[model samples]
Target: MSSFRLTLERRQQVSTLRSTTTYILGLLLGLGFGLLVLLSAGAPAATLLDDLVIQVFFSAMGLAQTLTLAVPLILVGLAATSAMRLRFWNVGIEGQLWLGAIGATLVALSDFGSESLRLPTMLLASAIAGAAWIAVPLILKLRAGVNELVVTLLLSNVAYLLLQHLLFGAWKDPVNSFPVSPRFDENEQLASLGFGNLHSGIYVALGITLLMTILVQKSRTGFYVDVIGRNRTTALATGIPVTATITLMILLSGALAGLAGGLIVIGVEHRLTQTIGINTTFSGIVIAFIARFNPLAVLPTAIVLAGIYNAGGTLKVFYGIPDAIVVLIQGMVLLTLLMVQFFSSYRVSLLRQSAQQPGQPST
Candidate 1:
């Protein structure tokens, strides 16, 4: 009996260790792929790795840019994380982001010229617009039982087209002769955080992350969301308001995504452009997945992704490699991490040998 108990304990220990090993393996695999990319580019792999290490850790300017890029990614990733936690797949974060920017642009152009009120007003309007955009697919899913994945993706394309039309047709700035919206007023823009180009968006993103962490870990609403996501049928049977819970989660996610877009306009780009939405939405999805849909984890993950983006610029200037190389590395890393998650959750074990001595106890 003691031997049997020891065997059982050993199995449990192995299982725990397996989970830890899986994530370490995933990180190493991602690094290997990055190294392979550098080798293929004809750069010394060790040197390239050293350079990236320096840029990410040692250079103050590089660190600032990393935080700057992480700002929007944090919001976008949180949006994805929130929807995902409630078992809602909101693939239209990109469209919602565009809607937010468009909404903010409208506010900037309107007659509300008070310096004190402009930023807050635009943020509010953008949040509403983003939630409204997401509501289309949410209603379709809840009312008609439509698959949200298709609806959300299709709406993203529609949103992009709408942005194009506005930029080229009505919102285009006549003085600049560019296919972009007018620059936001000084009062409406987000202020810089310090002497660097980093904006207040970094603080907003961090603040949102903190708030979400608290909500997910402490709030009653979060408890309901967790329950609904883990087992919707069970939750419904237990008197939980599954539909309302899902809707609220999706709405909150959309609002956060809108805030991300608003930050891009008011903080980084300072104007709405058609190119902003091209790949940023997709990047958000990647960041969210890479972080395992954890709201708190999104910060470090976003910062790492931003480092790659910043490093890609350096790679381009110093070497002849294309920027797409960085994207490829990101894709590989995400794929590997997903595989690691899968393996950690499941295992294959060989059947133990029967202990029957000879043919005595075959039964």
Candidate 2:
């Protein structure tokens, strides 16, 4: 008689078939769960399906809005992907986005910036502010070895509070009587690409994605980062400037997130609102993960996520579904994909052995 045991072993490399299968399964499972929720809610599954698959994605106006929403997602998704590639977990990208908006607001509202310099200065200010926002966490991690995930997450709340304080007090729109800031001038706005609801900022985001792809996939600094991600000790022993490299990567990540905020202000919203940029950071993280940290792949992934998220309103209207369902769907997809990622890196099997003999541990 033989006894059997099941064990998991780490894989040296994950095959494309395995990776692809994992993503497909995640997609199907997530949609299945969403369908169950709709049925339980007594909602029409047909309307939900049409809203999700046709209205938001196939309609002309809907497609425009989807791409417009994807602009910020693309920027922030690329930002997260960059840091994630280096194994730097930056959960404060949302805060960086808010801080970036603050910086742009400071410059945009200032009389010192001439009309010619106004927009450019605002964008630059936002990026610099974003980088500055992440600098604190990076320094602490490098010096005191504190956990960045906790610090970054907490800092995000601080950033949101600061944005609220300013909007509710100094930056409050005098005319609107709302908690929103004054809208940017005509000269400061991004033009549409002849498509209603879509802004030219999508082009800028696409260009930046291309540049980042090159920097991360081809540059020597990027190579160092990849190695560091694989093994920090090995990278350090190999004479890589681990601290400096990580610092640069973190700053750049923050800058990208900041730029995204800036674009949202000048392109879509044309002003800062209480809800203008909420939850974007988390959605961007999901986008990055779904894309597998590939900067180039982030384009389609961002668009897909954007279409789904932007359709939340339609789902609510057509099926009486709540916005929470959208969040739940995002979470489920992310969880399933993460599980697939884990499985891709490991193999599971059963080993049988004689009951009379001592069995060795399975690798």
Best of the candidates, lDDT: 2
What TM-score does candidate 2 reach?
0.93
Clashing pairs in 2: none
The superposed Cα distance between candidate 1 and the true structure at residue 33, in angstroms, equals 1.5
Candidate 1, residue 186: how far the Cα is off, in Å: 1.4
Off by over 4 Å in 1: 1-16, 350-363
Number of the top candidate by TM-score? 2
Off by over 4 Å in 2: 1-3, 353-363
Query: What is the per-residue lDDT of model 1 for residues 164-238, given as tens digits with 9 covering 90 to 100?
Result: 999998889888888988887778788887845799878888898999988887898788988988998899999
CA RMSD of all predictions: 5.0, 3.0
Model 1: weakest 10-residue lDDT segment is 1-10
For model 2, residues 188-229, the per-residue Cα lDDT tens digits are: 777868886788888889899999889889998889889998
Collision pairs in model 1:
none
